[model samples]
Target: MMTSRRDFLASAALLAAGLAVGPPLLAAPPKKYLGVQLYTVREAMEKDPAGTLARLASIGYNAVEGATYTGSQKFYGLTPSEFAALLKQNGLLMPSSHYRLGEEPTNGAPTLGTLLHGWDRAVDDAAAVGAKYMVCAYLAPAERGTLDHYKYVADQLNRAGERCQQAGLQLCYHNHDFEFVPQAGQRPFDLLLATDEKLVQLELDLYWATKAGQDPVALFRQHPGRFPLWHVKDMAKTPERAFTEVGNGVIDFKKIFAQAKQAGLHYFFVEQDTTPGSPFDSLTQSLAYIKKNLV
Candidate 1:
């Protein structure tokens, strides 16, 4: 086809318009999805779960990790499906959840969502709730026995991991300072690491690890690609060594985040056990710092 003078002028005008706008915005690089652990606002969640989630969503958190699941088979008083719907309504996801070891009897029956009694059911519920990972949240005083018991815990975690894998989810163990404490001249955390890597992984709690005087980088180097989740909590610098906002604390996050690939990090959640002020305010501060300094 032959172009007329009018068509030529029109094409030139279009080119000029494009040039005036400057290059097309190379679609702003995808923003990293930051997450928060619900435990950070436990009291608020316990009182008003829905409101708490909305507040967190407003704070720019893209995901949330659950911190409670009782024998009642309810997450903050909502069933798995209901809770999942609530999360979606607020534009959030539950990538992971915390569960107990269930080593002891509560009311003469093992809790439903624990490793002891109803783990398969727990796994099923976790899947229902849109969770990709199930974590052994904490070990109570009685559950944390000698090194031999630690071996038992490892085996149990492997079994649970296998179950989770069958449901297309991963199982992880969330560590506290107790695991790093030397027991029988061997760190129980090391024993827990004995779990089959294919079945189980670690959700390294950066604050507790630092509080115990363990280097997060050293752990990453020691077990490369074995960690998938992280609790990005921070520790205070005072003598008491309390919990604090992420960047306000002494913990060196930039140094540890640099090793994220080695740590096999897929998701991380900010958490503060006991915030000094309003938890939401504290979270806002932490998220601001993270956005400014870290990822």
Candidate 2:
């Protein structure tokens, strides 16, 4: 009933050849979701939010991080729910948004949606807009200038973070070169990092970090798992250190992105403070670079 000895030998040889050819090829890893910070195209959003969203989606961005949520109680003049609907219509997700700490005082009444003012309401709006992380976007000149100021900001961030956690959202601090500047022999960025990890996370901006002469990977090693969000932009090679499209400048994003796990990176947004031409054009270049090399 079985094969003859010669046939058995032939089958054995075929099996050995199959083994030599190696095991079945493994499936390629799932593509990571990449997003863009709406601030990259602020003007367009201000003019027409829905149209801007559609254009971004067409350019291959699956997600967007909001940069305007204050003053109007709306996102780009649309209520949180409306903005969320527009995003969904455009086949995009809003995973994170930017808010200010409100360290500086207003003229008459307190501003709403700031970490110092109406933070709980801000959290509600963030949730309504489908954001999982709310970032303290920037620090004004008056808000900084001293290490003590940073400690105060850290305390406020902790309180804000607690409220965010209650609402099922994470709080993060977005940094700039100013934080890296030494204040009385201490860096504010380091001071801010001392905040409770459970309460506050960091949104590291690669461009600003490089501008301040710090290595992004080194920071990741020092504060492993503290960063969950990132502003992905690049610095021009010239002395001006101008904003440039991703991969069109000097930052080694490939190296930085390789350390995403250590950085606790969940989402990153492409941002350019200013662009030479249309911002959408800049975003297109950055998205292409990220898809081709980094993601």
Candidate 3:
């Protein structure tokens, strides 16, 4: 998505008028594809996976990310192959899936062979659905209570990355605002980033990063290409700062989307943890805003 000088000039009118300068206008060639994390519509998906997916495709989503696959190694009760076919039928790709990787002590961690054939079929199933990246979605407060625990997690993630790579996938870590808090005057977030650079990629959540008072662009500058995915959620205007649809909130998405290349964005998924009404409706509103103003 290069912003050639000509395209930049063409978009100058919008910029001068202070209109939303979405990527489609400022950049050249093939418009960016957008995906939504299915968790945003978990209830609907849980009740009717097929119908939910069909609706998403119609709403202009070219891709999706799975948030859960916990029941019987099946994605929402469908086998990996079935899930892949469903995505294909909807004209979508599940390039990534959220999976919980144990940050256990390496000494007690699964052996390489165990990882391949053990009861923990996360990596295998994720691969089966054609996912190229497996992201650890959350770390319970108990799991990250201390620096040593985080270091142990880093070690485990490094080991897990090796296993994922063997399965033709990359392992990544997703974050919330909690990671930004300082521990003993040193941020554990830094320790995680300081881990095996090649082994650990980041799925940067823009809303959480901003809520934590950290600049998303600065993080990109600090660690180029380390972020391959993002959770493009927005915060409501209330003092509680609840989750809201993309353009409805106060986030400067247009500014941030402009830095996609430096952030090494392969794909980003719109994910609003809470919504005023139907998740599909929220998705529709977010998609419209993104297409016209952020891409």
Please state the error at residue 87 of candidate 3 in Å: 0.9
CA lDDT scores, all candidates in order: 0.81, 0.81, 0.75
Candidate 2 wrongly placed segments (more than 4 Å)? 1-31
Q: lDDT at 130 for candidate 2?
A: 88
Candidate 1 achieves a global lDDT of: 0.81
Over 1-295, each residue of candidate 2 has an lDDT whose tens digit, in order, gives 0001000000000111123356765554554667888877777888998999999989998888887776666888988888889989998888888887776666677667789888878999999888898888887777786788789988998999999999999998888887898877889998899999999999888888999999999999999999888888899999899989999899998999889888888888888877899988888988888878876
Score candidate 3 by lDDT.
Answer: 0.75
Clash statistics: count for each candidate: 0, 0, 1
lDDT of 3 by residue, 122-162 (tens): 78888889888877777645467788878887787788788
| Predicted candidate 1 versus true structure: per-residue lDDT over 1-295, tens digit per residue | 0001000000000112223376764443444768888877787998999999999999888888888885776888999999999999999888888887788677787667787778888899999999998888888778888899899999999999999999999998988888888966889999999899999999888888888899999999999998888888777889988888888779999999888888888888888777778989989998888878776
Clashing pairs in 2: none
TM-score of each: 0.89, 0.89, 0.84
